[model samples]
Target: MASEANPRQGRPSMTSAMRSSSFIKEHQQYRPPSKPENHYGIDTVVEDLQASKISSPRQISPFNGVPSAENPPTIVESGVSHELSHPNCTSAPGTKYDKLVATLFYKSTSPRVSNTVHSPVRVPSPTRGQSPKPHPSDSEFPPNMSPSSSIDTFPLEPPASEPEPLDHLYGSHISPMCITSFLHLMSTFPLPPGTADLNSAHRCLKLDATHDYHPTVVELTMSPAPSLDYLSLEDLRKHELIYRFEREWNTDVVLRSDTLWRRYPRLVVFDMDSTLITQEVIDLLAATIQDPPDLGARVADITHRAMLGELEFDGAFRERVKLLKGLPASIFTELRPVLDVTNGVVPLLRALKKLGVKTAVLSGGFLPLTSWLSGELGLDYSHANEVVIDETTGRLTGEVKGRIVGKERKRELLIEIAEKEGIALEQVVAVGDGANDLLMMDAAGLGVAWNAKPRVQMEAGARLNGDSLLDLLYLFGFSDEDIQTLIA
Candidate 1:
């Protein structure tokens, strides 16, 4: 029956034969397997999927999962094309079994596995005719080296930069205009050729908002042109640009060395008459003469001329002393308590002594007052003219016995005291208020004129017209706390 039926079928229509052949070819090629492992082997499927053909629909992805448009995953490869789309990402639409398999494979073998999806790899494509790059293998990275596991792989914060240079501005009252003009002078006046950006970076630091002296100090930080030579305080006194500004602003403009500003002076020499004390000792002595009641007035006029640089100091001094011929030596004892000591002298000298500074009085006044002041103020040295006392009467003999402690003598004494103390002349500071003090002031490292005459103020290194001499401490870079502690 099979032969007869098959012969009939074989010789029958060509449509029947075509149907059988089509069914056998189509069904046999896609026969369903008993197990998923037999149908989809990841290792074998990956090998057949070439890097260039990764986009082919026919190939099975090693990471089998549903593709996602919202949260795409990333894969790192040394030189592989980043154009490869992760079609089998677990978030993509897929069967539960496929997603489970993908999750397991990714957790076990993926180099970067995390809860959060990462950005797609953006490796640059290879040039024309270049070979496709191989993907990075899992074995290349250590277990703890992944970005998910290690902190070292993350970018770190950068280190901080250095702070700027700081300087202190000291004055009783620092107005906005004062600061502005001062900054302008420093930036523009002393610069060398091609120097630019002077004081470009500036900040003003005010320590106390409410204090005894308003704006007594302000900390300034600025970057000056490197090539510019800062003029000394002495030169600045006469500098036309600064002099004009100072005159207009009623401020003393000085630029002291940062080194000198911080260093405490080892020796501080003070001029006597009209400086340490309020009155000239000679004028005080001359006032005691009875014969010529106008002698004191005449001597005072001459002393004023001598101090103002109108008359020679030695001659004026002798002329004044000649008028004091009959004054009883008891005048010295009488004048001791009545001498009007300038304000802040006691605290200033006390502070200086506490700092181990050797203080001295280089005076054109007679020896008695200078000696008394040195003892009273704890000064280390005293030098002054010696008046000849009459052995017969305990009175002045109308003459000076030895060398006059004039301007030249003051300068010499400052040097001698510094040298004797084993201190350098550059460590000396001279404070005075007369024309005679000019030479001595210029000779020392720092010279401060205390409410001096117009000429003296112009010639000295610095002039203090503030309320108290204690403001001098500010010039030395001592703060409120530092000065209070030192003086205390």
Candidate 2:
């Protein structure tokens, strides 16, 4: 009767019968415990009933309160697929919740349960392709070392949220507020302390203080130590001058005492005619004669020519003296008080004497005049051609007794002084203003042309254009202080 109930119904029923086999078997194998009757709402039953109408071959549910076979509720996996298809059914495999549970339970705790859990197999992370980047603080250390040690071994503390007071960091103690205040003070009023001198508290502050905010600590160990004593004004002046000249000339040539005295001369030879004395002694002598103009010019020309090295010393001397054959010897006595010394000669001679340097008068002019100056200035020596005058007649015979002291004799005299004094040739200094003095100037170690002739200036080692002979002290490394002592 059941098989023959409806042949058309049997066809649909057969397919339903096959599909329901697994569900029915599962239900029978694991029978669900009884639930309360009110658990299944009427609306839920109606919904199941309608679904059965749409689907073929539905049957009665065994338990009314339980979920129907055709319309079971979905149970979504937590943190996995959130879509709800059926309330009573579990979520699909490979969901996020399944992975999380697998990680916490199976992978992490399996070691305790099994001794050979194969090292608790790791699930290759989805983020495995990218390497982890280091933190900013870790950059200080090598890659092989742990970053923790670097943080532990850092010399300075980390920047604080609230800065400390200035006094706390520098004056006395350490605190965040102190450090901040100190940094503020440094930034506002920064000064270099390293340049300060030792023993001076201000200098010590400058040396030890770090006014720079960026790097708070100053290293004073490398700074130079200050001298115990300061230099005097005179020494300071000399140092300054030396520094200036050295910079200007780009040379280390210093004005040293030993160099000056050694390089300069001991004997300064002077020519007495137009050089030492203002007027030409020969012209003055010629004035005493009757034919003053003719004889004076002639003698002047001879003196001039001989001084310029144009004529031989003896020849010029003989020629000039011959013209004065009738001149009175008393003319020298008359002109003795009238002769004038050059502007700077007196002071120069005095200074030279004080310096222990010798002065010599070498002249083609008469000895009478040279001898007077020699005695007045305390000159070491004097050489000149003598005018032979008849004592009773008080007249000149016009003959020079010795060799005329001209350019050759001037040079000869300079050499004689150097040889006689046992001084080095470099220790002889010759000063003259005439062309005739060139040979003597060149003979000495250092030749000075004092307000010299243009020709002499070119040949001399140094030239002094000014009338003040005090400048000559410079040639010997005599500073203003030394000059004061010499003049005094």
Candidate 3:
């Protein structure tokens, strides 16, 4: 009875053992083995495991369905008996692994392989005692690396050790092939240091070195020469000659000195009609004549022709004076007060006098007009044709005294004035409008064709296109600031 009671007491213990075994078996079916301890000899495998953890996909391994010898997959030592035991377990023939191993062996003499079941293995370094270093061209890594990535990795190892030397020689950082290529390039081109060739090569590389490197490339390619038609010797010489001529012509026309106006001329000779006074004296005189204004038009036509050198001065003067045969000389006295001077004449003449220049009026009109102008303007001298009137009748005299003061006469007078004043010919300045004035203009040092005829404009040295006569002060080296005080 006591023995039967003891059996009952042990029943619970037996039941507990059975339940624990069942639980342990179920856990083993699902759970991975615990990580192994790293002994000194086992450190390489542990390191590989750490490396694999870093490289492996985040999730469980895809080949986990294959059973492994160890409870948890472990890195197997390469060339060990256990490694060959799984020879059939390796990737089949013609697989990516086979190709990879073949490429490694071809590139390296004694390529190492890792036997880790689940860890990624780095293909080993080239054999320790190899003959020649494997060319990167022969490596499978280059083919496997994407074109963009390969290009990025080019210049893997420059032939030279330092970057600065390459920069000094080539003006840019060195390329992987640069040191090897430099000697060859120098041999081919053989340019002197610091020459344009060296500079050009450096500049070309600086601009184009960013390009992708090709494995097959043996040398750097130079850009093609521009398709320009170079000038021949004759063409170049002709162009140079033409350029020189044009430059000289341009220089001649430009102002000799910027301060031309400050150094005013010693003498300033002005044209009377239309230049000094607002209206033409002949035209004014013609307006005073009778017989229906037609005679006035005819006289004006004759005056224009004479002034323009189209008609002889003596002939035009005699013809016009003949038409005025019956007119009284008192007309001049009446016209004197009404004769209009230009806007800036009085001030300009005052400024000229202040500067010690001899100012004179040389006109083709009669003394009746010019005499009044000279007295009114306080001119130093005046020249003009004299009108002859019958002393007794005070009317019908058809003669002009002395030679007609036309173009040639104007030139003669300019010369005479320069000589009389004891001034150099270069010191004289002539200003006028008519074609007749061209002769005087040519004779004088500085000829200003003031609002001149086309013929005069073509012949004169300079023209006064502006409205104010004060601008002539600019030609005499007067500054705008100086003129302000003078004007005031």
Per-residue CA lDDT of model 3 for 1-488, tens digit only, reads 45456555646343454454344444443433344333322433533355434333475443454545454443445664332223223434564121000000010112223222232334566676865544344343332232435656655553332112222232222333443343233234323232222211221111122464212111121211111144322232233332232122111110222122325578888888878876777777778877765988998888887767688776777788888777788888889888888767888888888778898888988887798789889989899999788888887487888888887888888788878998766778888887777778777767876766655655676655445666566555454556667767
lDDT of 2 by residue, 245-282 (tens): 22222212211122335434578887787667777787
lDDT of 1: 0.66
State in Å the error of residue 299, model 2: 3.0
Q: Is candidate 1 or candidate 3 better by TM-score?
A: 1
- Give each model's whole-structure lDDT: 0.66, 0.54, 0.56
Residue 110 of model 2: what lDDT? 13
Choose the strongest candidate by TM-score: 1
**Residue 91 accuracy (lDDT) in model 3:** 37
lDDT of 1 by residue, 1-488 (tens): 45555546557454554454344443444633333332444433544324223333564335334334454434457876343343322222452210100000001111122223233455567899998776455323333333444457543543332221111233335555556656766566444444344433222222434455344344343333223256543454477766555444444544454453246688889998888898988888878776777988999999999999999999889988888887788889999987988889999998998888889999999898899988998889999999999989998889999999999999888888888889977788899999999998988888988888988988887777755677677666566688889889
Candidate 2 overall lDDT versus native: 0.54
Which candidate number has the best lDDT? Answer: 1
What are the per-model C-alpha RMSD values against the true structure? Answer: 31.6, 43.3, 37.7
